[model samples]
Target: MSAPEQRFTPVLLTLPGLTPTLALEILPHGVTLHRLFVQADGRTHDLLIGPENPADHLTQKYTNTIVGRYANRLPVNQDAFPLSRNGHSSTFTPQSNESPTVSLHGGRVGFDYVEWTPLLDPSESQLFTDAEKSHLNGSDGVVGVIFKRISEDGEEGYPGRLLVETLVSLVEPSGPQAESVKTGSELKLGSVVIVYRAKLLDEGKVTPINLTQHWGFNLDASLKESLTVKEHTLSIKADHTIELNNVGLSTGSLLPVTGTHHAHAEKESKKIGEKWPTSGYDEFYVFSPRSTPTLPTRVPVSEFTPTSDLLKEIITSEASSKDPLVQLASEKSGLRVSFDSNQSGVQFYSNNLTNEKNGARKKIHGGSGVSGAGDSYGVGSAAFLEFHEPLAAWLNPSTIGHSGNDTLLASGEIYNNFVKMDVWFKSPVA
Candidate 1:
């Protein structure tokens, strides 16, 4: 007679030290990132904007949850396509969620709505290889959890049984070596790493998949005095953005951000509210292609073993790179967050739709009550940075051979997506 009670497992991770500089809370439902606390300016500040109640995650607007099957939108007229791969062919038709003509964030019931099984003990799961198990064992200041789930065949109109695993971890920051350090005010840094991997279970079935985390961030440290990100400085390393139609669907064309308002924060950091666009940014900034190692053609499920190599590769690449793909900083909090990913582009949404008029009130300090616009909890209160492949590449027949392949996962192949968020604090020199 009553609805089944929803359940969630909360996992806490803290920096390894006598006094922790950062703490993170991860929930297996939707494999959500519930909370993040960063110590800066001699105070502890909550960095993420989420619902007051954890259970609200299911109904909220993707506060901080993993989106999948397809991360962004697809046209409503999604025609069935014969995916011919590995000597087999199957028709694939994506399910629509937003409208009769558009599918938003993987149809009606996406990964965000499901409860992922947590692999707290990697040794118990066959998905991880021995090396991956050891890496997940969390030694030497590393702590994380792996959440996994299976999407049955025909769910959401996608073919094949998909086994998805998401690894979320908090690691101590690696700064300059002691010998190279100058004796000035040092910056304190901490990192949150997310790795997504999936494989098709059917021997010859193929499917399309794109995954991303919808994390809305508000850097102000004080929950009682929460403020909009209007004053925050933003910088993105993108030269162009995919053109979108009036209703926000990709137009199958790329436009340079060189002379538009999109370029305002491309070259240098700028206040988010300065000369703001009327509708705010719901744009996908495109990044130049990166040279990454290709995966093997096929590895049967029985012989397949997900490794730590993908995670290591992301860390190694970030360490060697000079600049991050995206960066956001707040002068008030003296805190900065940087994002680096192997994906080709990132979608930046300025929380433009969150307002009382829209029935989307801001929740303070993850509390139950709502706040008014004057309280800085309304529109522009936060920003969502989603890193993933080009939007609707599959809709265009011409580009499907190249950019579109990023979303296709074939039988005997592995799917991996890596993203890293580094948080730091730097005080002004006196």
Candidate 2:
């Protein structure tokens, strides 16, 4: 007998209005965010960079996909940690997938490559409360889909059986109280909200876990234009960045962003191409604890109610009281995207390694009489913003203390990761 063929089905989430402002495509393979269409300037624009065909996602490198077991890189030699629950104790050790020296994004077969099961009736989910389920099922103009998966114990050199649930939703602007900003036009604002929840199913067991979405963005709207994100301006609400070694792993040191090209403060926006570094950015930016409201690392399953109000609180807190955690605007499209998350830090990558040689495809417009055809993308074609705990912080808390107990999930505990992206059109003057 032959191995069974994998099936890929995508779910679409949209607002309640006849002319919805936003639409999101959730691909089951890896529970990837396949595409995001935003209506602006009387036209619909695709804000995310992804493959044209759904199956093409398998060939791409974490393109708009949820990555985990562990999100980022981990040292090859991981120390065994003790896990004790109800007087039962055992040692846990993490396995590496990248090479003998490192582990990149889970293991060789991480969540990114797995096919997640879609929950047709989200009410049956164990991760949401009744209030949250009602709110997510169209109340307050919210629509979403939940994808669930089970990671068997020792699947990726990690302990415990993990139940993971990912909720991808679109929340439209509700009334005057809706979290929005005035750009050039009086466009109603909306957002793409992603919530990741996980729990250990094994009794008296523990595991190390870190989860995140790796979505590459290009505001150009069309691949035919073949524009790079260097033309975009960016701002971040961070004062320090995690120091990295030559191989790109955290050195357990936090360094100031002042007086550096990486210093794109909330008040000081800078063009990504101006004074650019050869390697582009693959660094982790640390967020100040006092800058945003404190969020719990673990929520009891019974009390895990992520209502619309909670979503608003996470994204709007920055919109109302402070600048967004990170902002990127495109001058060509008049489109801007702001991100806010409960994670302790973010990773900004400029797609430095993407190019025609890497099999990235883009539409090429012919000159004069020549016809247009498909072509490969070049380096810096897009910007990737990953919201998650500081990389490798679980190994050395003293050096990256902002994320206390974020990567460790104990028995009977639930882990929640929330991220929101608000999109709207902005006039050049504004």
Candidate 3:
């Protein structure tokens, strides 16, 4: 219990049920912070940069740290979320409020909280080779963490003998940082790149898998009150959208959200806003370049200054001394993101609030952070972000032992998708 007030340290949880084996390296840039490790608990999971404060989860109270077992809920009508829908398996399935269908991420013990084991070096021969294996020791410039889990047949009511393994790596930054590391091993102007790969082993054969992370982003501490993301523009070059059920669950309908009005204004009004009830966004956004308007490549779409509301593409958040403005721009900005997944949908939430849990606010120690008081952090400081999702698969072992004969579900064949995110930060305008 030797915890410091304003410093960062490695946290180990000896809680029950968990084997309590290893711990991750805590990374803090300043007041903002996070953790980094390769081999968690026993399975593999990565947030690219590990896990940020998740920006926003459960209204900033931090309830939903990572993606729940299932990204969203299953359709009320379906007995269970169908592993295969139509001809394609969508990674980001939509949300649903109906019937037995519920939300599930990695089911109970996902990757986020798992303590990973670092495999520094597997061997030079294994490099770039598709040999399908595991390594704990990572390289000096890179980090590799590995983890695995075997789900029981009826764990989450799925049907698959689930033997899943994930590998996460932090590659060396490719920018200016790589050039000036002459003195030692220090990076200058490069960003950390995260990569995740997981597969389901069936009778020692490769099967399909789905996975994602539940990462939220809040530019300003108090996402809503700061009243800025508008400055943060969104420029999405996607062509297809998966129609979600009432609660946002993917109904297996991948279409375009462009022309679909939340409602028809007596067939007269050209401007139609979000559907009647809720305001905050809770829908999956597809990344399709084919359906894009193809604006300039380097220009960013300022969400703060919305040109259109087809999607919450980018956000612009700024604060001026006299009347500061937060702006997010995207002129396509030579920046493009591609999302390929096995699930059906993606969810985005804003941190309108945070937890007063420990009486005051929680200051992030591993990364750059915002204060609750705007200039300083106290109680109730919030964070917001857009994140990936990891899928959930229930395995059965009481029957087949090691061959993966009795499976509750085929699980992650669809969610094995990736999101291409390029986030840029610049000093506040003078």
Cα TM-score per model: 0.87, 0.88, 0.48
Candidate 1 residue pairs in backbone clash? 52-366, 76-101
Count steric clashes of candidate 2: 0
Question: Which one wins on TM-score?
Answer: 2
* Order of quality (lDDT): 2, 1, 3
Backbone-clash count (model 1): 2
Between candidates 1 and 3, the one scoring higher on TM-score is 1
Instruction: Highest lDDT: give the candidate number.
Output: 2
Better of 2 and 3 by lDDT: 2
Per-residue CA lDDT of model 1 for 372-399, tens digit only, reads: 2222346677889998877766554332
The global C-alpha lDDT for each of the candidates, from Candidate 1 onward, is 0.71, 0.73, 0.29
Candidate with more favorable, higher TM-score: 2 or 3: 2
Q: Using alpha carbons, what is the TM-score of model 3?
A: 0.48
Candidate 2 lDDT tens digits, 1-430: 1111333566888888787878888888998887788876566677777666667677776889999988888776657666554354456665666667678888888999998878889777877656566767686677888899999998877888999999888877644644233534534458788888888898777677788999988887463464588888988777788888766778888898899988987666689888689888887788766444555667755565455234445433445223567888887878888877778778888888765444435321111211122344557877889888877666767555454654778777788888878776754545
Clash count per candidate: 2, 0, 140
Off by over 4 Å in 2: 1-6, 78-90, 175-183, 186-188, 221-223, 301-322, 360-374, 401-403, 427-430
Superposed Cα deviation of residue 103, candidate 1 (Å): 0.7
Residue 47 error for model 3, in Å? Answer: 12
